[model samples]
Target: MMRHLRSIMRITWVDKVPSKEVLERTGLPSMEDLLTRKNLRWTGHLMRMSPNRLPNKSIYSQMPSVHRKRGRPRLRFKDTIKRNQKLRDIKTHSLASLSQQRDKWREIVK
Candidate 1:
């Protein structure tokens, strides 16, 4: 989306400023920011859910051992959470602690 937005700007003779600058000027959050917020929101939702509410706990907590046909395996959603946690430097392991604290989680997500 960022690339496409930049191309649109270029075609409009507005390439002098960076894509981020244009997005800011238009009061829109970048794609990355939107994805990050969504990821965090989903995490919060999952954390609040009971074992019965979640379709299958194994999806997030376990990976079946199997050999791939042959190619780079895609990163899983669980891996993405870990990567985001590391990137954000979240120390708490039990993110569920914030299930009842909306403001705190929002701050952490940001």
Candidate 2:
């Protein structure tokens, strides 16, 4: 339908970058105007080298969570005890060997 086609065309135009003349006419300064002289030069250099536009918000939101909050149950005393036990085991096996190796190296150097 004509209405559907017109809506699609309007959405396409929304993604277009505005021109410098339009920015001036709107009384909106460029990113360079807000940054210091050094930062402006650095920004210009980076923009010239890699002139790619940034990703949309929807793209950012789709990224995997690096950290999760599982709430109070995960941070309880039982969980702390389990974590401490694991740390103790690591220190007894791996860290103890590393400490002995460091002491041996120090004795050899001395």
Please, what are the lDDT tens digits per residue for candidate 2 over residues 1-110? 32344354453345553445445545655544433333323322332342254422322244465686676534533343334435333342443233345454233222
Candidate that would win on lDDT? 1
Clashes of each: 0, 0
Which tens-of-lDDT digit does each residue in 1-110 have in candidate 1?
66667676563544467776879866788787778778877877777677666543854566568787778889888777777777667655556687448888888887
Estimate candidate 2's alpha-carbon lDDT, on a 0 to 1 scale: 0.38
What is the TM-score (0 to 1) of candidate 2? 0.18
TM-score of each: 0.71, 0.18
* CA deviation > 4 Å runs, candidate 2: 1-18, 37-110
* TM-score for candidate 1, residues paired by index: 0.71
Q: Which residue pairs of candidate 1 clash?
A: none
- Residue 76 displacement in candidate 2 (angstroms): 45
* Candidate 2 lDDT for residue 107: 32
